[model samples]
Target: MISNIAELIADRIGTMPASERRAAQTLIANYPMIGLKTVAEFSAAAGVSSPTILRFVSRLGFQNYPEFQSSLQDELAAQLQSPATRTLNPPSPGGGTVSPMLEATLDNMRETFRHLSDKQLADIAARLADRRGKTFLIGGRFTDPLARYMAAHLAVIQPNVFHLAGQESMWRDRLIDMGKRDVLVIFDIRRYQNSLVRFAEKAHQRGVQIVLFTDQWLSPIARFARHVIAGRTAVPSAWDSSAALFVVAETLIGAVTRQLEAEGAKRIREMESLR
Candidate 1:
């Protein structure tokens, strides 16, 4: 599975013809810096044909160049957010013209759902339905909203759902007591937080089951996760479009809710009667 977008592009370059490799190299170097204005604009900037850009993207497992570029931009945003790294390019339209951000968001959502197989969705739902254990969500920085959203929805539908609270130190304290019976749901996409990865690793050591919602299969946090669900966050700007992530989050919640309603309706009815 492709891990990082850069590695995907590099692999494509290795197999591509010499001329295409040069174009790919140019695109890689200039991307997230100069920013991709459009297909024709990128073609001119990369000194290659638009068809070559399409091929490069296809080689990376994307349908076309736009998809590939969007993913790259998302990854770049993640990395640039780190205090150690400076953002090379500010979030701005390269051609001094506004591009359709909403269109890109809708396209990303469409592709994300298209690529998600029914089996994968079912599997995730099953994981969430494991009522034998507690579900704990861990997310930091840009992804905190996702974790909070999932945890809140799950809490109402499923018992024993917990969102990691407090500062990093508080989370660390809570992690010290976590064990295998607990499920750790982590959201770590581009510009991933190191603390989240550490939490996953520690949780893994305790035999905790991890479910990761991230941008790619090769995300570092995926290494220790039991289940990894991929979501497309690439957008026209430096920051990722959360539309895809939100869709997946809602899907997971809906599936889990339906499962509970089907299998645990009697329990729910009893509890409601007492209330």
Candidate 2:
């Protein structure tokens, strides 16, 4: 969710002590362009001590220097692969620059898929296929489209699929009313919204089953959720690409739909006749 590191730094710069402002400025100015440069490298570039860099990261809400660097690297990688960057330096005829971008996206997806165990998928499939539970799909801001898509697709083949959208004031309290028989499926990526976290926390307190689809295992909301499915979508264009996430969402819905068709077809027909 940290789309522009510079902008993020700038927004928070006023809160930082005057001593750290210069280091913060340096990060804002030359973040995505710089590779995996160490804190020492950044410190030298910013004409500050490494400890100052550490403080700068802490001030920005990162747990430590290493965590800050990891987040920055992900943001930088996305920025570099953005279409705007590619357009700035067009490849020569038949040079095939797009291959690298494509490969990077595929590699990310492969790593994410590898990280998921069969047991995890099976458990998630079971939850999604459960007819007795109400499935609440929640996403905010940039990820809202993903949640809506999943909810709509699943609704066609499953019952009790709900998409939580619109203003938080209107839906937040209602969403929390879900209980143990309900599952909350939340999609959150980097630069995640605070409101989503609050909603997840509330849902967790109510004993609702929580399924999270996110970019990394280290996501802050992961702890509150019952299941975590890592979506290794490419980070490009200062925006996280949800291509892989969408694929996973659809695949999950498809699996659950198949199960429902196999297990509940007769009941589903009876219910449909009542409607």
Candidate 3:
């Protein structure tokens, strides 16, 4: 499936020519900041000529720069477009002291944090602390890195950690090895993939515990998840924000670390000694 714009850019970056790839890299690294800037400003920052940037946009299937910016800006407006915020519309069009996008980000965080609880954190931590079977982290096109990030820290402190590949063939290969004792963590966002939803459902039927991290719209797979962690919604943009989902990953890592306690500390020391 075609991913959101940000994910599309990231997916294509490796195959792009040197100049275009550099331009893509700069935006990925500093998205909202780079996204809001004029084409000239962004092109200059990427060290490419202005026209090159426009071509890059076209490569991503955008009709023009404003269309690109509007997609990016949508992520900012999406969350704050709640009835109250819209009805009580701010006096200015986000050009004053507070950037509307920034405000939306704060709102997203607040909502995400508010929904999180000690019990839920501890439950996920317990699942990670269990050593019987492998821990599998599965992230889709846009969220694969977050899954890998989760695998990285969990692997350091624990015995079995695996990052599941996102491709259909590779994903099924990985799923075949999973069983009742294993735990599966998935990260999925909007423009959902039906195949992935089916994968999650199959995993659930196998009795593997599922932990899901997703955006506000909620994945259809959430129903099958043993634990569902929802991210705050971002404003509408050519790309969407996983900022809230990212925090969820970090928090889970922290909780897992705490749960491991003395065992975790000992493992870290041994790992450090090997370096």
Candidate 4:
């Protein structure tokens, strides 16, 4: 049985026909979220025909679309089942509706940290601490602010932190060097942009170490990422929550701060002195 339907789709997405590939990318990006939504809903969202989505599903080795959805739910049961959304929950003992939202945010942070190993965090911290290589950070429309904020935080304790938000000229200059021992940190969640994926692929081909902070749905960029931090984002709202994403940014700042030691401290002191 295919325990990882998302990974299976991701594995074969590159070779799928154009229309099928579009539908598959949407499915992979939303992951089990797509599982709860019907084929019609998914097709409309993917801008593809229902038959295209079905063929994409069948190609993934499922008997039918319903079977595929079932596999996705089974594969991602833990993530899909959020405590905040559970109907079995008693009314807040405090007798208020607001507590669940706050508690879910805390839970998001806890789950994010729980899955990330200390060693992995430390290694990524080490890469960020490198002064020999320039650090370039980028993210999609929704995630760009987080990337910018991380760059700001890194700059306080280190040199060579560059935040790249797309302006055609800026991207051209920033990406001029390949194989230059630079670190490219990307924050890519759902609705994954092909532009970012292509850039990441190109960077990887040029020996850039890509650090990716992404939703657990995972992206094609995962194949090229040197460091992949997958976090869960659950909220009661229509939009995807970025609370867990902030936890990761803060964690990276904390890790890199500690990893830099004397030099990092001295840089902070000097920066503060000027202020």
Off by over 4 Å in 3: 1-98
* TM-score for each predicted model, relative to the true structure: 0.60, 0.60, 0.64, 0.63
Clashes in candidate 3: how many? 16
Q: Poorest 10 consecutive residues of model 4 by lDDT? A: 83-92
The best candidate in terms of TM-score:
3
| Candidates' C-alpha lDDT | 0.77, 0.77, 0.84, 0.81
Evaluate residue 42 in candidate 1 and report its C-alpha lDDT on the 0 to 100 scale.
70
Model 1 CA deviation exceeding 4 Å by range: 1-99, 262-275
Model 2 spans > 4 angstroms off: 1-97, 263-275
Ranking by TM-score: 3, 4, 2, 1
Residue 100 lDDT in candidate 3: 67
Worst 10 residues of 1 by lDDT: 88-97
120-166 per-residue lDDT for model 2 (tens digits): 87789889888888989988678889999988878877778889877
| Superposition TM-score, candidate 1 onto the true structure | 0.60
**Count of backbone clashes, every candidate in sequence:** 2, 3, 16, 0
Better of 2 and 3 by lDDT: 3
Better model by lDDT, 3 or 4? 3
Task: Name the lDDT of candidate 3.
Answer: 0.84
